[model samples]
Target: MRPAHLALAVLVAAVWGVNFTVIEIGLDRFPPLLFSALRFLAAAVPAVFLVGRPKVAWRWILAVGLVLGVAKFGLLFVGMDAGMPAGLSSLVLQIQAVFTALFAAAALGERPSRLGVTGMAVALAGIAVAAVDEGTTGPLTAFALVVAAAACWGASNVLTRRAAPPDALNFMVWVSTVPVLPLLLLSLWTEGPARDLEALRALDRQGAGTILYVAWITTVFGFGAWGLLLRRHPASTVAPFSLLVPVFGMTSAALFLGEPVTPLRWCAAVLLVGGVAVTSLAPRRGAPARRVDPDPAAADRAEVTPSR
Candidate 1:
């Protein structure tokens, strides 16, 4: 990658890292589902107009949206709202990589390399440590919800690979369009019109603007830039940088939310980062060579020609 691209990647990581903080802020004012709905709505509208439609099957697009947008974010927000700490949420969400690897193996017929297996094991160990640290009293249910969110993300990865959108930008734009309505419906049904109206009416201008910022800058721009990076680089090259998210998340939470990062959690972070590195940095095995059919005319010409 060029220096410019590298810089952009760093910027994206920072944005995503701080996203937990942003979510915490937004949730203080709005319900989780409503906050998520508004975020997606903000992302989808201008994106639909500017990027237009992606050249993909409607089913695939919908699947992508349901998995990535509705399932992932919805579960994440719920988990956070249910008492999962923001710093912990950031760390736990990294489980998506493990889920993605497992899904790829199961759904795509891809075999895991030795390094991949090791990486996953290491990462899992880290998660176990984190879980222990979280303890039974600290909203185990919320943690489970985050794990569910990770599984949804993994499913989305498989769908995305299968769909193989012609362009990432178009794919993102189109898939992003799928989540708004479902999320709105969910918000209405669960949160109720009364609570929704109350929250909307009571929110100060600053809170409303924060939601808009979370939607446009964090969701749309962040994901758009991410899609662009994925299109330009190999997943192996790009995906590992996401490890920084928790690091940033922890730091941001400490600074902004007054959350503490204990020594044990720091150790867990090391194991997690190491595990992810082991899996991602390993060498890939060579694929079997493919045979090509000889041209009929060429074969005939060869038969007619004199032997050398």
Candidate 2:
């Protein structure tokens, strides 16, 4: 990657890293379901008009939205709200790589290389360490929710691969539409209509800013720049940068949110991030260079490796 693209990659990673803390901040004001719903809402809207529709089937678009937007994010926000630390949430979410790999193997019969297996083993070990730590310090239910979120992310990745939309950003924008109504109804069901109205009425500057940051900065600019990078370079070249997310996430959490980075957690971060890098960059003898779709969300969702 060129210096400019490298810089852009780092910038996107930082935006996504800081996103966890931002989500936490947003949840302080908006209920988790409402907060998540508002995120997709902010992402859709008039911009949808400007971006227009993707050249994909409606079924695939809506399916991707339900899995990616609704299931993955809903579980993540709820887990974080239930006391999962922002830094830890980001780290645990990396397990999506492992889940994606496993799902691909089972669903697509793409068996892993030896190196891939080893890398997944290392990452699983790291998760076990983190889970043990969480058991002692955080709510196990929250931990479980985050794990479910990772699984949903993995499933979304597979669905996106199957859909194989022509225009990534446009598909992402249209797909953003699917979650709005479902999430709104869920917000009303879980958080209640009264609480949702109260939160909206009481929305403040920080909360509003948080919502915009997630919609524009994280989802739009972050994924937008990333998609461009993948288009400009090989998936192998660009996908490795995802390893940096947890680094920024943990460091920023410590610096801004004052979340402590314990020795064990640090060890787990090393293992998890390193394992993902290995799995992502593992040599594939005689394998073709993975074709990077125009979709940024597809790239990020399938961070383990680019599709063959």
Cα lDDT of model 2 by residue, 1-308, tens digit:
78999999888888888888898889889999999999999988766898875777898888878988889999999999999999999999998888887887777666778999899999999998998888889899999999999899888777776776555567677888899999999999999999999999998899899999999788767766776776677667777888788888888888889999898898899899888777666753433345776655454334322210
Q: Quote the lDDT for 227 in model 2.
A: 67
- Model 1 spans > 4 angstroms off: 283-308
How well does candidate 2 score on lDDT at residue 66?
91
The clash count for each model shown is: 0, 0
**Clash count, candidate 2:** 0
Worst 10 residues of 2 by lDDT: 299-308
TM-score against truth, every candidate? 0.88, 0.92
Number of the predicted model whose lDDT against the real structure is largest: 2
